[model samples]
Target chain A: MRRSERLVAMTDYFKENPYTHISLPFFVKWFGAAKSSISEDLDIIDAMFEQLGIGRLQTSAGAAGGVRYIPDYDMELSKEKIDEIIELLEDPQRILPGGYVYMSDLLGDLKQLRIIGKMFGAAFKAYDVDYVVTVATKGIPLAYAVADVLRVPVVIIRRDPKVTEGSTVSINYVSGSSRKIQTMVLSKRSIKENSNVILLDDFMKAGGTIHGMVSLMNEFNATVKGIGVLAEAEDDEEDRRVDDYISLLKFQEVNEREGRIQVARGNYFE
Target chain B: MRRSERLVAMTDYFKENPYTHISLPFFVKWFGAAKSSISEDLDIIDAMFEQLGIGRLQTSAGAAGGVRYIPDYDMELSKEKIDEIIELLEDPQRILPGGYVYMSDLLGDLKQLRIIGKMFGAAFKAYDVDYVVTVATKGIPLAYAVADVLRVPVVIIRRDPKVTEGSTVSINYVSGSSRKIQTMVLSKRSIKENSNVILLDDFMKAGGTIHGMVSLMNEFNATVKGIGVLAEAEDDEEDRRVDDYISLLKFQEVNEREGRIQVARGNYFE
Candidate 1:
């Protein structure tokens, strides 16, 4: 293959497998290029990535060393994206009965999910997260999106156990809204012992769901590294069970009868 | 930026946004390059993609015309991956009580999901699938994965209604296993009327769950374009409620008492 062709293929591979290593020899074998030539190509790729602010190539110079793509998300771009989404959410039509925002639209957009996922990944990227955990339904997509960006497994806590999953570990915790005891379960084989986990959800109220996730993580001897949500109920921050978390938007005063909704960019910037 | 640098960045953008169009002017503005220069860069990228079999860069030549990245996956790589995973599933340790195969590992692995998602996307990419639909719990991740590849939204069917999702359309279908009546639902706004959707899942038994999803889609006035499953039980194929679906792997038998498991690549290759 020619130099430009090899570069395109290499760029695709590196973008797909971020924070992962690819030795010079593997590139040499895959592209049938010389080590020195591959090194020069890497320089070109790294420079482009640096200019784009999409990611960076961390190259180590030794036999055991290789190049890694570390996603270097632009905070300004993220803020703009989040601001745009927040504006979309502020519409009165988005406010449903009982103060619920129509979150499915945001959850259902691929472009939005990519930005939200990367934003979450950027916030908790420093931690050693073995699993991105969330409950079933709405939170599953958010959890998977974060996992996609972080390149980790997503452990979903189902509301009810299914026969297909085999043995599981179940727990009961208070719902943030209802304050009623709710049971969530994870398969016994889903997570490994002593793993680091990051909890992500679509929305947070009193944070009882997140608290339950923390308890569920303990069942497998896992530690909670961080907590992040796409949106948080700004009204009940004082009543939340979990602190030290991140959110992209703060939803407050969502009164359907009044046709009123307040949406602001979350603490992701702060 | 130079043509070479633009080629690399364009490749990354195309890979990230598959089956989406990028107008020439957007590239022109983003790169601060001339229209002719951007055109030349796209040509180089398209040539490279054509040679690599990763995807194709389709160019349109009019005012509304632009370039699109259509991923043309290599089947040999996909077959090898499917065969390799089949070997892993054949491991006796993956077999669980009542002949249930432990699937969380595959569902959890980011790399595996990428391959599986891409594999499913390749099969249904030609279809005009507006939404990738799946029932809650295990199928959520798979649905999101395929949606990622196809650049579409995922509509999840919840077993029960949540106020957070707003108003929902519900349907009842008989569970293929227990033959018990069960209900599944989707939010009214998640999918539009007459949308084309593909039903995706982690596993298929009597096809009852997928059957439930098809019925749920009907309530939205949406059409079920196709159905794809990661694995299907061969023993119950004749007993399935739905026909005309694709599966990547076949679960023939799982005798936990004797610790014997049988697995084969599904109809995906054929």
Candidate 2:
């Protein structure tokens, strides 16, 4: 293949696989091109990704290293995205009964999820996340979004044991929103030992679920990379677990007459 | 900016907003180059996307013409990805209650979702899809994945209405698994009239919920662009409303006692 053709193929491959490493020799063999040619092609693709701040192309020297695409996001881009999310949350249309925001739309929105994922990914990118973790139901989207950008797998801890998962490792954690003792379980095989995990959820109140995830990680001999929430209530300041976390938007207050929302500062977006 | 820098910038711009249009004048102004030079740059980018089969750079000529990048995936790539998913599902550990395979891992897997998104995007590339639609719960991830690659907004129909979403338009449909009445709803403002929608979900049993989406789309005067499911069971030889659809795997049967999974031919590795 020609240099132009090879460049395109490499980018496409990286985008689909994310967080994967590729050696120059593989491309050199696939394209019947010189090592120098593949190197030059990567230079172009790497520069493109870096300038965009959406992904990173890292070149490893020596024998084992070739090129690894690190999926990431720009802080400015993240800020703009979160600002839009906060605006959406504050919309009178989103307010629902019992003070819950009808967030199913935001959760279902691909664009909004992408922004949230990127924000979460950006926050945890530096921490070496192996899996994006979330408890059953609503947290699935948040976990999936982060996993997509990070190019890592996601581990879902179910609210109840289903026969489909066979044997599982269960953890009893307090619910952040409901403040009830809930049991979350993972199929023992779903997670690998010594993996780095980033915990995420759609909404966070007391963060008891996140603490459960932390404990689950401990059970698996894994590491807790970071924590992220799509919406965090600022009023419940006493129950948070880790200070090192990011929230795309903060739900400041809710009343019969008015509600307040604001985007929090984070590493993903300036 | 230099040609090299301009090339990098344009590529990055396209990647961040994967499937969107950019006028020639936009590039011409950004690069301080002639229309012809911009055309050449675009050609290079298009060829790269084509060679990789991961993106499309389309050009329109006329008073209102410009270029748009539509990210896409090849059928062969989709097939390979499906095979991988089946392999994972085959792990015996995934078998859950009610013949539902534990899909939390696959749903949470970012790299897999990206491939799934790009492939689904390719299938609907020719369709005039406006918003992605799905019922609440499992459909959330499907909507998120499709929305990511299609660069379109997603509207989620709730199984149960919550206070946050305000007033909703409800639909009653049959569910695949139970063949029972299920309710799905959409906020009045969520989907626009005359919009073109693509329906997606993670699993298809009887495909009753999809029918509800179709009805809801009708209420909005919108068109059904396409329908897609991540996995479909073979025993569902029932009435079909979807004219075009794709699935990664076709489950032949699940023998719980033997801990065996039977999967038949799927388009993904074909």
Candidate 3:
């Protein structure tokens, strides 16, 4: 392959496989090129990703070291994305019955989820997350999106035991938002012990779900390194079960009768 | 920018934004290059994607023509993935109580999901999919995977109405596997009218969930261009509700007491 073609192939490989290490020999063997040429190609790709504030490629100079792709979005890019999310949340037409903003469209949106996922991934990328955890239903996509970029598996907690998942470890907790006692289950084998986990969800209200996830992670002997939500509702501020987390968008108020919404940037930027 | 560097940026851009068109002038403006030069860079990318089974770049002729990227995996690569999945599924350790295999690990696995997502993306690339659809829960990951590859949005159906989603269109359908009547809801604005949708899920046992999704799509007057599942259970062959679909892995049988499993390639190849 030509030098131009090699760069394209190299970028694709690294982007597809983030947080993965590939030896220089692998590239050397694949391209049938000298070590120097491979290094030049890496520098070019690394510079491009760095310049754009997307991520970076790192080289290990030792015998076993190759290159690893670390995807991250800088502070400025993150702020822009959150601002856009807040704008989307403030759409009056999105105000549903009660105080809920229509998040399914945002959750279901491919582009929207991608941005959210990337932002969350960027936030937790430094945590060395071994698994991305979330409860079943809405949070699954957000969890998967984070796991996708981090190149880690996602452990989806279920409200009910699934027949298809085999044996599971079940736990009971009071939902922070609903204030209802709920039973959630995880496959006994879903996560390995001592793994580092990042908990993510689409919405946070009183943080019953996020609190439940943190407790569940304890059962696996895994550490909850970070917590993130696509949007956090400030309704239950006094009743919130968990503190010390990041939210992309803050829902200050949603008036169904008035057809008004007050939204702002989340703690992620702060 | 030089041709080599421009090729890297263009490849990354198209890879990130598949199934979307970019005009020549847009590239010229971004890269500070001439139309002819931009065309040459696109050709370089088009060749790389074609030579590899991963994706393809197309050149549109005439006034409105620019370039579009379509990502797909080759036959050899697809086979390797399915074969690996079959091997993984065949493990007796995966057999769960009540004949359920422990797939949370596989489903939650980042590497595994990426492969499945890319393969599914390739299979349905020709569908001109407007949106990727799936019922909430386990199938969400599979749905997002396909959507990411196609550069389209994902429409997730909720098992129950969510206040945060505003008004929803709920439908009652009998789950093919459970044979129980259930209600699944979707936000009114989740999917646009007359959309070409591809329905995906993690497992298909009688495809009750998939059937529900297909029915839900009808409510929106959307077309079910294709149906893809990560795995399909052969247990309910006689009473299966839907027949026309694609599956990557086939679950031949699972013996709960004996701790045995049987898996094979799905109908995708056939």
**Predicted model with the maximum DockQ:** 3
DockQ winner between candidates 1 and 3: 3
Q: Name the lDDT value of residue B145 in candidate 2.
A: 81
lDDT of 2 by residue, B131-167 (tens): 8887756667777788877878777777677555677
> Scored by Cα lDDT, where does model 1 land?
0.86
- What is the C-alpha local distance difference test score of each model? 0.86, 0.74, 0.84
Tell me the lDDT of model 2 at A127: 81
TM-score of 2: 0.86
**Residue-wise C-alpha lDDT for candidate 2, range A35-62, written one tens digit per residue:** 9888887788777777778777888999
Docking class of 3: medium
Clash-forming residue pairs, model 1: none
* Native contacts present in candidate 1, fraction: 0.78
> What is the per-residue lDDT of model 3 for residues B149-265, given as tens digits with 9 covering 90 to 100?
887888878888766677789999988766799999998888889989998888888878878888889999999999998888877777888899998888888987877799988
Instruction: Tell me the TM-score of each prediction against the true structure.
Output: 0.97, 0.86, 0.96
Native contacts matched by each model:
0.78, 0.63, 0.89
Error of 1 at A28 (Å): 1.3
Clashes of 1: 0
